[model samples]
Target: MELRQLSHFLAVARRRSFTLAAHDVNVVQSSLSASIRQLERELGATLFDRTTRRVELSPAGRALLPIARHILADARAAKAEISAVQGLLRGQVALGTIQMLTWIDLPEVLARFTKAYPGVEISLLEAPVDEMIEALRSGELDLAYLACGVDELPAALTVIDSDTEPLAVAAGPDHPLAGQPGVRLADLEAEPFVEFQAGTGLQTVVDRLCHDAGLKRRIVLRTTQLELLASLVRHGLGLAVLPVGVAHQAGLTAVPIIGNTADRTVALVTRAGHDSNPAVRALLDLLRPDPAG
Candidate 1:
C-alpha cells in the first residue's frame, strides 16, 4: 500500500463517513473509497464494516487504526524533518495532554508555532495520563503535558517545569452542599462521587485524599474526561475532584477541600536526557526560556 492510502484510511476512520473524509482530504469520495479498498486488499484485512447509516471499525480495523495513525504520523514527521535540513523551520511534533486542557487558549503559542513554521505539523492527542506516558515512551508521542505525582519520572523521561494548580471538589450549583463555606472529607463520605478510573493521576490523588481522611468515597462513576465528569455533576449525578483550573472553566462550583488533602501537579514530560528530538526541545524552549530583556 501507499502512504496516501493510509492517510485516506485514517481520514475515513476519523470522520466515519467516506463523503466527509473525502471533503477533509480534498479528494472525491470515489477516489477515497477506491484507495481504502486498495489498501484493504493489500493488507488482506477489512478495516471497516459499513452500513448505510454508519461506518464502524471491525475488530481488525479497530486494532489497525491506531497503528496506522502512528505510521502516518511518523511518515509526516520524517518528511518535515527532511525539509528542516534546508534551513526551513519544519518538523512535526506530537503532543499528548489530558482532556482538561483541550479547551484552553494557547494565545499565539500554537498560532505562531504553525505560522512561523508552516511546513511543520502539530498533532494533539488527548488521553488519560497512563496512555499519555505510554505513548511518549513508545515513540508515539514527542512530548506530553500531564498531571503526575509519582516521586520518580518514567524511566528515560525528563521532567520540565510547567504551571501546576491544585485539585478541588466540584459540585453542581444546586447541589445540597454546593454553597457550603468549606468542604470537609467527612462531608462527602457518603456522597456519590464521580471520579477517574484507577491508575490515573487525579484518581490516585482522590484515593489518597479519601484514605487520609479516614473515609472511603462512594464513587458512582468513572471517566477519563474531566469535562464529562463536570457535566455529570451539573446533572446532579455526583460530585468530583478535579484540577481547580479545569473546574473553574467547567462552570461548576469548586470548593477547595479543607486542610491539605486535595492537590495535584501538572508538568511537561519528555524522553529524558539531552538526546531529545529537536522539535521537542524547540517547543520546550518556547514554553520556558530566559526572560526577554
Candidate 2:
C-alpha cells in the first residue's frame, strides 16, 4: 500500500530478479523482498512467480505494472513541482538517447541545464529506438531522443522537437560507386552493406528504404557501434546509409539518394501525457531551437 512498496515492486517486475532490482534501488535483497511481500499482502494478490532459475511476473503483477508507473510518475512530478516553488529545481531526470549524440548537440543542452539548475540530477541512458520508447512508456525515462520519418508516432508518445535531414549513401573513396551523383536505392541492390543491429532506428530506416526500392540489401555485417559501421564502410567492407554529417566526418564519400526514399528525422520524444517534471521541462526548453536561428 505504501509508495515505497510500489517502488520496490516495480523494480522487481522490470528486472525480474530480486537481486538485480535490489541493486537498482540501492537496497538489500531481503529488504526488497520484504517490501514486495508487504505490498502483495496488502493487495491480496501474488505478484511474482519465483523459481530457482528465473522469476516471472504473475498476472496480478502485470496488471499492476502500469498503475505503479503512473503513481511513481505522479509522485515525482509532485515533488518536483514543490521544489520548483522554492525557485530551485531538485530532482532526478532520466533521459534516453540513441548513438548520435554529437549531431543532437545534447552536451550543449546538458551544460546549459546543469548550469541553470545545479541541484537537479541528470542521468543519460543510451538504447535503440524501440527500447527507448519502452523505457519512456514504463516511466524509466522522462525524455528520449529517437529517429523516424516524422509523419506519425505511436499513440502513447509525443514529439517535442523533430529535425528532418537527408540520408546519404556512404562508400569508400576507391569504391566503384564513390562520388557517384544521384545514387538511387536500387543502384546498390547488389552492394554489400554494413548496418546497425536490427532493433536500432537507423536500421529500420535503411530496411524501409530498401523494401520500398524492391531490393533486399546484402548486409555483410550487423553491429551496434556506429563508428565501427563507418569504419567498415571506410575500409571498403561494405556501403552504408548514414546522416550526411556523420558520413562526411568519417571520411567516406557520401552521395545523395536520387529520390525521397531515405531521410533521417531525429525527434525528441516523451510519454503523451506525462510532462509535469520541472527538471525535464527545463531540459526540453534548452533543447528547443532558437527562433532567431
Candidate 3:
C-alpha cells in the first residue's frame, strides 16, 4: 500500500492505542483509522485486533513490522543521500543510549544539534547496551551510547567516541565497610547487594566482575531506576557497586575495589557501514567537534 499507511500502521502497532497513535502522527483518530483500514483492505489481512480495551497486533501485523521498518529505513536513507548530494542534510537519525550517563551532557548537545540541522528529525531511545547494539545492527538506530568492557564490543559495531570511569563499592555511612579505604571484591561476597536490573549496563559490568572474581552476592533488591537503586542502598537494603560519580551523587561512600580494574566504558557506537547517513554524520560532528577548529 501507500507509505503513509505503513507509517500509520507502525504508529498504532507501537503505541497500542489509536488515540495515542493519532496524537503521535499529528492526525485525527478517524483519519488514522481510515488509513489502517485502507492498508488492511489492500493487504487482505487484518493488522490489529481491537476486541479488548488494549489494542494488540494481529499475526499479520507482527509479520509486517520488521518489513515495514526496513522499508522506512531504506526510504529515509535514500532521501538523506539525495539531500546530501543537493548540499542539504535531511531525514531521520535515531540514537539509542543507556539510562545512566555520568559524563555526557546529552540534552545540551541535542539542543545545539536540532538548532543547527532543523530539517533532520531525531529520535532518542533509552535501552540496555545489548538491545541498543542489536538496534544499531538492524538499522533501527544510527548511533548508541553504551557501556562496554575492554575488547567486548559487538562485531559489526564501531566506536565514534568513548569515556571510562572506575567502579566502586557503594555503602551507606552507617555500614561497617563505609570507612574502608579499599574493599576487596571478596569482601562483598557476604554482603547483601542492591543491584540494577539485569539488562542494564551497570548490572552487566558488576555481574561480570563478580563472576571473574569468584564472588557471589546476595542481591536483596533489583531496580531499573538509578535513584531507586541508590535509595535502596542508602536505606541499608544492601551495598552496591556503581560508578564513582553515581555513588558520589547518591551520597554513598565509594570505596575503591582492591586489585580490581572493572571500569565502565561509555562508547558512542554505530553499525560499521551506517555512519554514512548524512543526518547521523551531522550529529556525530556535534558529538565530537574538531579540536583544531
Candidate 4:
C-alpha cells in the first residue's frame, strides 16, 4: 500500500526472518512487523506465513514481489533524473546564432560547456539575425547570438552579453581599393557589391550606412553564406563589407571605413520572461566573462 511498507515486505521476504530483516533494514523488529501487517491489511491479502522457527511468503506476497520491485526501481530512476537535471548533469539546450559566428568564439565556449556537462546535449543552429529572433520568440531556440545595433532589438528579447567590433571593407587582391587606407563609404558608391540577403543584420547595417552617405549601392549578388560572400570578393565578383575579424580570416584585404567608422555590437539574446533550462543556464554562466580574469 505504501513504499515504506513495500520495502519492509521485500526485506522480510528476502531474509524470511523478521529479526534478520529488521537488522538488515536498520529498523526495530516490531516496527518492521507492524509495517508488513499494515501492508497485508491494506491489500486484503495475507503476505506471509510465520511460525516460531520459520517464515515463508504466502501466494499473494510472491505475486506482488516483482511488481513492488519494479515500482521502487522506477521511482528511484525518476528521482535520479530530477537530480541530474538540477545538478546540471543531464539535459539539452538549443542555441541559435547569426551566420557570422566567427567573431564570437562560439566553438571555444561550446568546447568548454561540453567538457563540463558531458551528459547535456547541445544543438546549434545558424541563421540570419531576423530568423534567430523569430526562433527565440517561437520557443524553438533557448538563446541566440546576434550582431546588430542594441537599439534594433525588439522589446520582447533581453540582452545577456554584448561587445562592439569594427566593420571593414573586404576586397579582392586585384581590386583597386585593396591597399587603400581610410576608405570612405562614398568611395565605394560606384563599386558593385556582394552582400547578405535583405533580412540579415549585416544587410540592415549596410543599407543604413549607404543611406547615410547618400549613395545607392550597386548590389550584384545576395546570399546567406558568409563563405560565399568571401569567395565572391576573392575572385573579383564584387566587394563586401564584413566584420574585421571575418574579413581577415577569409584572406581578403580588409580596410577601415573612414569618415563614419561604423561598428556592430554582437550580443547574446534570450526571450524576455522565459525560464531557462538547466543546460541553458550552465552555458550562459560559461559565456559570461570572469571578473577575476
- Over 1-293, each residue of candidate 3 has an lDDT whose tens digit, in order, gives 88788878877876678987787678999999999999999999999999759999999999998888788767767776776775445667888877678776788999998998888788776766766666677676888888886377877888877889999999888998888889889867788998887777778889999888878999878887888988888888899999998899899999898877768888888887665677777788888745785
- Where model 3 places Cα greater than 4 Å from the true spot, the runs are 1-62, 85-89, 289-293
True-vs-predicted CA distance for residue 19, candidate 2, Å: 14
Q: What's the lDDT for residue 86 in model 1?
A: 47
**Candidate 4 residue lDDT tens string, 1-293:** 78788768866776678987787567899999999989988999999998989999999989997787676645544543564557777776768777776655778989989998898878676656876776566555678888788788898899987878888889999998887886888877789999886767778887887788776779999886788889999999998888888888899998888888577788888875334365677788887767686
* lDDT score at residue 8, model 2, on the 0-100 scale: 89
Count of clashing residue pairs in every prediction: 1, 0, 0, 0
Assess every candidate by TM-score. Answer: 0.71, 0.75, 0.77, 0.67
Model 1 alpha-carbon drift over 4 Å, by segment: 1-81, 102-104, 150-152, 197-199, 272-278, 289-293
- Per TM-score, the best of the predicted structures is 3
Worst 10 residues of 1 by lDDT: 272-281
Residue pairs with colliding backbones in model 2 are: none
Residue 269 in model 1: lDDT: 77
Residues 1-293, candidate 2: write the lDDT tens digits: 88889878877876678987787678899999999998989999999999998999999999998899888877766776776675554676888888854455788789888898898888776766766777788777888888765565678888888887778889988988885786888767789988887777777887888788877789889887888988899899999888788788788998888865578788888886445666777787787788788
Winning model by lDDT: 3
State the lDDT of candidate 1 residue by residue for 125-144, as single tens digits: 65568767766765657777
Task: Sort the candidates on TM-score, descending order.
Answer: 3, 2, 1, 4
Please list the residue runs of candidate 2 whose C-alpha ends up more than 4 Å from where it truly belongs after superposition: 1-71, 101-103, 272-275
